[model samples]
Target: MKVLLLICVLALTACTKESEELRMRVQQSIPVPATMSQVLNRGILYPTAGIQVTGVVRVVQLSSGKQLQIDSFSITPGPDLKVYLSQNALPGNHLNLGNLISNNGHQAYNIPANTNLSAYNYVLIHCQQFNHLFSYGKLQ
Candidate 1:
């Protein structure tokens, strides 16, 4: 009876450890900002398998009327993942905003606004498919 109980305890301990490791795998990809009030004052919903993500890239306008360029890039789901932006809609000089691949959802490239809008008027969100598994972002 003593030996049987010891075996059972060992089995339970091993299962617990495995469970913990699995939980850590599906973690939030994005970092939560300290001052979410300013950016996410409207509140944002982040899709979670078992992780938390907060914040998105925003275009901030400086006092000057010169569009500042911001760029960010991330690897896609597959090697061949590609992104295309609206040439006509985006600011003329501010091309090459960044690339969003199929695997990862939208990543932000913050550009300082040069117009009176004080924010980005037009944003082109690109993904391989509309209903992709990793489609996530803050609700405007």
Candidate 2:
């Protein structure tokens, strides 16, 4: 009985640590009255799920760096998917925001401080498993 309790405690601690790594640390949200661009994603290498990959991609400039917010966002979930801000709307030339948080709804990802927002004009949903671009939004 004691051994079982010890195992449970260790498992819980490991899970807690993993969850902490996934959280984004953000400070200060400097909002622009309106989003600079709104976009829609269409599946690449195939037709995206008909649900309409849609959302507003806004920039919330922060003290540490820029936070790219996906507001009113929705998409079909895929394996090993991730978010990115890119110039060419392709997979490689992008600032990887991290693993995607959801198939729909609002979320925020950190944009590196070195990134030039003017050059990175689009946000992409990319599948790391298949090496495909799931969808994209062209920043207006």
Candidate 3:
């Protein structure tokens, strides 16, 4: 039993290390676009995965208007993930941006043209199928 448990622990550690290495490689490869010039707000996403989630959430003013950008973003991948602009830390009273496109790297979600930007203060990465919050960054 002790030997088996030790083996499992070692295997899990190896897997975690490999995942971290892969995440770093992907993040390093994403180039920030020059068109992302008008930064309206910024926040640092915090992990709710019980593992490290690192990224910057930016509200940028594009020619089309305001949109949210997740830059150099990474988090543990899970199923049925979605993004939200919320008034609270939890998922309720939220504006569902749509399904998350990737578990790591840069992505953007559009804010409705009529949205009152000041009303929502959090950018949430949530697991809709499980109703779980994966992480969040407070909009500033």
- Best candidate, TM-score: 3
Between candidates 1 and 2, the one scoring higher on lDDT is 2
| lDDT, candidate 2, at 137 | 71
Pairwise TM-score winner, candidates 1 and 2: 2
Tens-place lDDT per residue, model 1, 1-140, is 99999999998888434566565753343222222223321223233253333333343333332222212322224333222222323233223334442333444333324333324333333333442322133223
Overall lDDT per candidate, in order of appearance: 0.34, 0.67, 0.84
Candidate that scores best on lDDT: 3
Against the true structure, what is each candidate's TM-score? 0.25, 0.62, 0.73
Q: Positional deviation of 113 in candidate 2, in angstroms?
A: 1.5
- Clash totals in order: 1, 0, 0
**Candidate 3 collision pairs:** none
Q: Write the per-residue lDDT of candidate 2 for residues 1-140, one digit (tens) a residue.
A: 99999999998888434344344432234222234443223223222545357677667655555677777666777888888888876777888878887777666676676777787777778898888777877776
Per-residue CA lDDT of model 3 for 1-140, tens digit only, reads 99999999998888434588788986775334335469988899998747568899988888876788898988888788999999988889899988887888788877789988888899999999988889999988
Q: What's the lDDT for candidate 3?
A: 0.84
Better of 1 and 3 by TM-score: 3
Provide the lowest-lDDT 10-residue window in model 3. 28-37
Off by over 4 Å in 3: 1-34
Error of 2 at 76 (Å): 0.7
